[model samples]
Target: MKLTRLITFACLLFWLTPVAGQSLKSGAANNDEIIYHIFQRSFYDSNGDYHGDLNGIRQKLDYMQQLGVTSILLTPLYESAFYHNYFAADFEKIDPKYGTMADYLKLIREIHRRGMKFYMDMETQYVTEDSRWWKKAFGNTQSPYSDYILWDDKENKKPSTIVFNLTGLRGYDGVTRKITTANLNSEASKAYNLKLFSYWIDPNADGKFDDGVDGFRLDHMMDDLDNKGRLPHLFQTFWNPLLAKLRTINPKIKIVAEQANWFSLGNEYLQNAGVDGVFGLRLCFAIRSFDKKLLLANADSTLAMLPPGKQQVVFIENHDVPRFSYGVKGDLTKLKVGAAFNLLMGGIPAIYYGQELGMTGTSANFGATDANEIPDRQAFEWYKSDTGKGMALWYKQTGPWKDQFNDDKPNDGISLEEERNDPNSLWNYYRQMIAIRKANPAFVSGSYKTVNNDQEHVFSFIRKSAGQTILVAINLWDKEAEVVINAGGNAVNIIGDVRPVLKEGKLVVRLPPFGVGAWELK
Candidate 1:
């Protein structure tokens, strides 16, 4: 047992297809959008430089389709000195390391061609000194973009470290210089952002809408714009107005905000910021930890805060935190439980690129540079074979945690090459669960109702829509248990090896540790 390994949609029966006025379809919720979020530099490399690019992602569309993903979320593609690309050097061009603007445009066209949604992540809150506005307007009162950037003093040239304030903090070496915050309220800033944002939604200028991205992920989204939460003028003056303008240009273009301090504070952004979706970080943690009570309470409380018509993005892991697999110490059974919860949960289910492969990484000590968090964004392990073709260890010798990410670790239960065909692997578990969800529409656009089961180790719920319902039962234990979950339905379809016999209208089954099953009710 030595090392290494690893490892949609339809529409319209007069259903939620894009209409003439709406560029994005609603009503389907996130279940209809199985999002695959990728950090480009760590994905697949097509250029042989060991750096992944837009072309690399385009090359893997078929692989994504095979895995049942209908949407893809890419980290910010704008030119940047930072590896994460959240702080942009230029909002208009694709980073040369990624490829040309031509290549990016081509990728977008292909993604939409395959009936998939493409979402590009952007911060729009900060920019590097290399930005055109920063270069021209810093300490220059006469320049048109002078107010576009925030300076510590009207006469000072150095940009304020902004909200997160990394200027003086000491850590890794990448950010030797400071990144300035954008004065979001300034007409010049909004005007510039609007232009950049507009171009991505309808890149061809034809207004066909199909050729460009379907949405944008607003990174570090907030209502006040600062940690103090005192500058509460932006949502009313900045975001709402800007989003309204964008909607006028392309009504279906979706906007999702990564609410500032998302795990604890997101409802305000969703309720007042006018964004289409916000990340449900609290719920994500609940599922990952297998806290049944907390998971239910948090989900119900958070969902109640959102006004009807708004949705939250639910995921087990993203680029920001440690991988779920690592959180559970790479125990494959727990990994399967986490996967089932994420994919089958309510709201939009986003899959971090290598999450399905049970990839494990941690970056708890982030500092001056992305190098501090590099381990979490390690290259996708394409195979245990060739050391290079798919092993995109772009930050190998540079990051602080490089040694911690050696893919050769024994019993990793990771790597796409290792898990692609293994029936019991985490990769296949995701595929099977996704298939079950897709076949049952209720799981996608249904109402979530918590089912009370007397057994303490079993957690249950029903996803119901119209006349159909599917009860999902999960065993959050480490040992097999024979239990009866009081789901008022007969099993029409069963998943995994565990089968629950119906007795007195209750589901009775002996489930292995961390087992999951779904029943289509009569």
Candidate 2:
């Protein structure tokens, strides 16, 4: 069935909310809120074709709704040369392979009906060889799109200004790369790239751009082009104006950039571009490496680096990188703890698809060094009976389970379906942490203070806002340890997982092996 039709029917199953309220609240933060990542192709179809269609996602509105995900980030849904949808073939089309234009509209309607927002990933560089823009530019050297794409000039008289294709390819290879001299600047190339960008934002069918997209995620801004080291400035020239026009369509529109390579550069780039938020690389790296100290420290540092009122978007993983479980290599406990921290942290938290379950992959597979990674890019697991009452049914229902070929041996003891119903499961813990964060104002947009703990294996901190305080303590160690909480006052145990007692005006708490606990001030 068509995705729109499925969404319209699904709309009947839930109570709808207004679109205005779906915008981010100006105050601190809300814990129940979440951004769920979905690769455009991973959504389902009734035909059993195996490729995820828009309608497939529409059919599963209940799954996302139940999880309280406030926003859905669709990874690069635009038409691309590859299934991954990075190399843009046509920005206008909605990738017929995913679904029809109507299907996308239905998705927007269904999502808004549930009071949730949707974000589409936009890859800024490299359109396909056969793209209309490219063909038009090539055919008419003086056409409007002539300056929209890149091409190498074959004839160069001056030896000093001449350049060589480092990747051993032809001119303007956006895929491989090139190195140009300092004196050599291509006004024509810049104009061409900007023109193509303008086409994406051209909504009214006229040459002049009017209405375009809700927002954009600037791709590959960190890399230097032409060795100028002015990529951000170049982006601002093209993107800043485009952002202004997009905001005119919806004042609340958000623009996030993928400034991955480094945290400092990403932060600086976002600030310079006046973006709403930046992808949090620090949190992602920590979760992927299972280095608890580094994770907590990086989170702290990222928070410190941001200017007041500007926020960061936290995620366990994204499309460009490997999945957290696969990246972390089956450390379910660390994954759970990292997730809890992400939820409790002050920034907006994003969850990539298939992260809730413990997914695993090796460097040989996902790192681009080996050919095996292609097969490892398996789809999510959706439906299969829980083996031994272990929650296989829930896993199958929640996942695009057929994505993985080896159905017989799945990740050991990792299934969102099982955890959703089980109160003590990791899923339950996440839900509870979100609930606690939501109920308390301190956890939202509060000030963070690191409490001095003697044990290096333990990480502790407090969130204080509007005179309320919530302390979070994690036993990064494998064995039990004593947590000393010196709040200088009496605080109530909110989660009740860990019991504490007052001693000499300080709160002493006993932590279990690899345990975590939270407290609330009375």
Candidate 3:
């Protein structure tokens, strides 16, 4: 039974209903968006093929919208030999394991029809041996595609390695495959990537972005590719020019870059590379540390680095990093605290899929293979028993790789089925926090300022805009504490468990262990 477009639309209509009296209002600006980042391969399985596909995502639209995210960001969907889809074999073709091109178009259309944005991840700096460039050019000096890939020898037999000078990577299927760096210096390669990016932005070429992705997540974006100095000044030579042409196609297209140097604030990328956003990697580490001073310093520095119209994509976890729940050791209160900071800290919040459900995973030291990331990118647990329809456990029976898998615990209150119905669950806490963020404009597009507090254990900040002011405070300690913030006025508790009162020209609130509070100053 093929899932027809009509049937899919019917399902969309059914799930699009507002859940639990919460509905996302349409026509919100991009700056006000909450992005839900998904590693689609482990999200949901719709065809019972054990692999998550475009159709699987279509079936879960209601779940995403109900969670209050305004946009969706997916990892690369191009055909690749690797499970994570970074080493592209073909830039133009959709991975056959995921679905057909029709499935992708339908998914994009439905996503736009619901007033949500979609972002595609692209890593065109490298390619696998299976790519057409490598096949036609390797060892063929006379081949026209010779310049398309960087070669270490005149015969073109030895292709340049990516990142750590590694020529090969082990895929999730336990097969080791060789990879080569794409020659970004070649004019042909740059032109090809420009065309590839333009194709996804408007597949039909009619200038209507209804069936195309709203933007792209430039993976591992760096001026000096791999930091080897081989591809220096790529921002001027490759990216800036390519991106300039893309905006001509869609003026509103957004591009976010994953800066290679995580320690740097990425101000250069925003100021020069023409990117709209960059991951706040420093801020993420601070939030995970549960230290008030670290969080305050990083948060201030991160926001200060952004250009006028650019944004800092704040998050606690992504496909490459360990889960926040794992870092907090599965403490529910700490998970809620993480959620509050992720939503109310006055930046573009991106919630990794399953983060709200308290999913736990950590990167393993599995030699030089890409399988080390498998644990962090496990299947999304939909059922409490870890067995049911739409469970995309593709790596379940795959030998040693599955041995490293520690996520998706069955009947452990970590699955969506277990958390969705419990009001006190981390999932519900995320939902409520998102609702609060959407209701307050200050938390969305306002200026972030650190609020001085008497206690060192409480991290306090204020998000201010015209006619709106929101003060957010989080208790970083494991014991209940009372803190006095340096702001006092008529205010009301808008979110969290505690109410703050004014005394001695200060706002005083009692916070429980790992507690959070948001108050709207009048």
Candidate 4:
């Protein structure tokens, strides 16, 4: 596809321009500001056991520091039989597959030493059958937690009988019965019933539970998995206050909830519930929209939906979801556009481990075969190091992706190492955006307004905080788009060299396809 450009004012005016009275912020402004995501144990592994460990993460301090990341949110590192650690067997100990308590503390120290924060993903629901609590709850008698977990067993006679067949859920690997709701309140349930608040913060759990990780990402926050209310009092009633107790151990911790489908009920519950932030599902969709109008529409809608004083965890890709490559079907141009949005737009941005470099996967049923499920789970092809073979390999060697290699066709000819060195690479684009966000508080904590523009394909917004103002504009169409910024103020373009001069109270901007521009009030 050819890019539309307009030549005016004696300069090549490509898509993307800046306007005035807008606020912007980037990593350069705050040394202690960052948002990070933890994924499957494939980022770094010293044992070569095909699983990433806490110590392996310790080895990559320089890489994270280079990105100017100030916080890390790890996936379920606490012990569990499941690969994702969403099924909790032991809430206190780090999974043996990942590492030990010493390794976890070392990783924490490493992150804190660099002036960063740490958090983990948590499953507030069931535990693995092997959990001591489950075993102790239901002895030899046939109980709902019989094999070890007590569901709300509504169907069975004894109430102890488990019920299965939950729709839209990827069932766990186990024996032959389904767990229903009737068993939850059964006589057998009383012994092993795990309350959401009591599990993770067990002060006396030196023996079985007690993984000393800081913070938590309430996994599947919007799901009614146990037949609870849509929002569930489990979190609002119990977990929120429980976090306060956990905070006694470390006061500076942070918590982000993974309420992926929260848009259905609105975000008030999450924001008002005292979480630091919730996943930005709407923003993720905005990045995926190749159409400029759709992009702006989604972006505007999301900004409108968010309650004041609350934050969204904006990310291009996450472990549980398909990557941008899958969404764009390996289209590099669209992928770049998505990355631009993730970095430039409002909210705390997070990048999945492999998203920086292009990785590919789809929603095909992997069946019992784990090899070909999602692209995000695929191993790092180190030989195709342009996109980041060494880092990818490091992650693969340390993670579950070790067995799947992409040797024949490396998705993109750029690696983390290669892009970091190239000034115009996506890696640097991200750096520039982060720098802009850090430099302007308006971008970080400012209120936003959609700039009215005559062009349908151009997206423009002003971010203002305190006395600072920054303008952000993007071209969604392949054709050149002319936009008029109505806000008052002479602004400097921070993303690139393209700048707009205000004349007669209007700043006109021309943007090329998939282009991004940022303007800061001078």
Candidate 5:
């Protein structure tokens, strides 16, 4: 009781609230939201057909819960022609490949039952050529839907960015099947989009907010989220108005933008347009650079840039980029170091499914072809026995590309089947770090300050809130490193693997080649 009293006193002295009203009102600092981003088709296949479906994800909720995932972000489920599902054909339908509307509602209920949030990825900015609107407008520009589609010519250009597709309609990897960019300037498009977003949020039209997703990942959103220059004022005009309506329907709904690119960070998006968060692409690239100065500077600048009530989702790998495991060739020590940095950082952290097991896969080129995004979207590798089955390598023997075996993929027994049994697996490393983040409020939502260290390869920082201070030291190298951090207190070695001593009031520790050690000092 006395020890608890002393600890409480220590924490009270260094209050977590940097701003009293902001901290007390929303208590955003206590929001330790961690999302597991999944390309549903590749996660886990429930049936024998090899395509992962809603039931597959439902079966794996236990695995996600065990890993401490508080929410999930799935690739778009709307009916579309391609495997990635970015091009929506029918906004009202859940792709048959995935399952029916009943399956979706069941998944949502199961997710809510387990006390997890669901966030859907929505790309209402464009639609496939066969869309009802596109089909009607393509042949007859005089159709009522004419104003909804963006055409290169009023009557005859055929809408081509890929020879015959317009810029917004043609996907980078050549996947958009004659995409018809929605005209945000048109009231018709705005009404259609609002109804679509609203339908998913409250499908039954009953007052209960339980049936719809808790949040949304607005894909490829730009001020010109639809297409640049076509409608410059769309965001300030259409999006702000639409989002305002959404808030009225479900006030707690979170809206995060996958902004156009890495340099998109700034206060303008959140302040002017009112997006809840944007991808921290700049920080993500820096962390992947494997450089200490840039990594530290970028992280500091980013956290400092955000105004309260806004967030930047931090991640090392995602569906769009090459796997982090591939960057380091699946080295266990390096993977753990990166894991420590990612989970401990204050911004909302996300894990691309299989990132923990050192999964390696990517479709690096942006050329027009089949499953141009397939390599990285490979199966979750539940078992080591079958390579093609259950994996979402849908492009195998389909056409322009063949089966790509990622040489960097972890060796046999690294699959979930094996890692679940092994105590010291990379998966276990992620599990531990997430558990630590959940246990320590400072690690997930506290204020961040860099801990200066003379060692060139060592990067250290202090994450503090209330009175709890967490010192995270990372060695971004392949050799053993001895570093000293300038923090003093009654310290508890957060991770048991390495013990740091307090000599003359400073913490001293040694990090193995690419090792990480976190400490709790209060």
Candidate 6:
């Protein structure tokens, strides 16, 4: 729990100093964050319920601190019939399975006490049949909440569904529950959302935000709700107004939206919507593909889309996407490469839980059910045997989803306990990369520019902040490569194995297969 300030020497190229315990002031710049995204149900369990809870997260702060993340983002914790807690049954109440409201408050307070921020994931667009609005407004035209739930019929016999006209979704409990979209245009619904958001921003309305979440992750945010063409101009009408009001309560409350379209650069959201950040999905896909041209193009366009005071949450894995290790077939070298790009890229980097340990899982096709995503959201492996006191195997021996769980293996070096002591482990690589990033300003809040290289297999770039410049090169191929960068500078090796050599007017570096290198230019 000892905290020390990092001192960087001009002559030294690499410094593996830990900055985890450093106290970050509240309302810090969005670009200053390095987030760790967690799916609580798959994380550690404090009790004997086989399910991860708020208290469980509070117990793992030390683990996250050692991993060098400044913020924590949890998926929805609201009461929901689904296992992922997306389709809320009640927006105001915390899911009983996760814990009580008191537990949530304690968790948030503990996060803030450790100088770490917590972002709550909210999907207020749709609710299940158990929701108060749906129960009261589904069939009663005279109900005061009649306009709260969107209805497709004048007689209120049919309710509006979400994307693909999904009237109901099968929960992990093997029960299909009907879902209906909220009437976003209804002033009553808008006011209710604003009140709900305000409550979470300052739970006790004490003006101080230490007890509440520092921000929110708006799930599946879009101007046109569900792309059904029924709701339009929501950016100008619904989001902007509500977010603007929330800003009045806490000007520093950060809101990051998940653009509905994965292919989008989220420019429209940044321009029109009152959001501080959005997921850099295009760059993430590009990095996963390991295509230099695609990576360069996406990186450039993604960064260019951000206006001042806004940021892109650059990440390779999330609760919705397949684990990055699965895409690479658990290749250690490739996983390390991913870690480098995730932390060193010029954006607000986010590390998904278990990503540092190279956990592998892919989305499975289980027709018309949310269970298909359970593979990607399996329990966190705490021990080498994948069984421990705090292990949260909530879905174990459940069904097809459990059969497809490909994340944990005995002695597979994919658990924190296995990787913590190994110097060359994916976990250590992530820790070192994060330390290097935190110690260097260029990697944290720098301007990114692609550095031309001679080898097609190597991708090179420079991150410059103030007067400091750092050159980074990665060999994406499966063989060793010696690449010559066009930039002329005397570079000192920093984080990776590649040693830069200056010959004539260019810098040359040799990289092993799937190797990443960074140098501080003199």
**TM-scores for candidates 1 onward, in order:** 0.90, 0.76, 0.93, 0.77, 0.89, 0.93
Please, what is the whole-model Cα lDDT of each candidate in the order they appear? 0.75, 0.56, 0.84, 0.56, 0.74, 0.83
Per-residue alpha-carbon lDDT of model 2 for 257-331, expressed as tens digits? 766343342556555766777777655565444445665556555554555456677776655555566644556
User: In terms of lDDT, which candidate is stronger, 5 or 6?
Assistant: 6
Error of 1 at 354 (Å): 0.8
Cα error, residue 495 of model 3, in Å, equals 1.4
Per-residue lDDT over 185-270 for candidate 6, one digit per residue giving the tens place of the 0 to 100 score? 99988999999999999999999999988899998898999789888889988999999999999998999998886667786888
Residue 479 CA displacement from its true place in model 1, Å = 1.6
Q: Clashing residue pairs, candidate 6? A: none
Q: lDDT of model 6 at residue 262?
A: 68
Q: After superposition, how far is residue 16 of candidate 3 from its true place, in Å?
A: 42
What RMSD, rounded to one decimal, does every model reach? Answer: 7.9, 10.8, 9.3, 9.0, 9.0, 8.8
For candidate 2, give the lDDT.
0.56
Which is superior by TM-score, 1 or 3?
A: 3
Tell me the spans in candidate 4 whose CA falls farther than 4 Å from its real position.
1-32, 139-164, 167-214, 222-232, 247-251, 260-262, 329-333, 368-373, 380-412
Can you write out model 3's per-residue Cα lDDT over 138-178, one digit (the tens) per residue? 88988888888988889999999887787887776778778
In TM-score terms, candidate 5 sits at: 0.89
Quote model 1's TM-score: 0.90
Model 5 off-target regions past 4 Å?
Answer: 1-28, 156-176, 225-227, 364-366, 387-393, 406-411
Error of 2 at 122 (Å): 0.4
Error of 2 at 333 (Å): 2.7
Top-scoring candidate (lDDT): 3
Mark the regions of model 6 whose C-alpha exceeds 4 Å error after superposition: 1-30, 397-406
Total backbone clashes of candidate 1, pairs 3 or more residues apart or in separate chains: 10
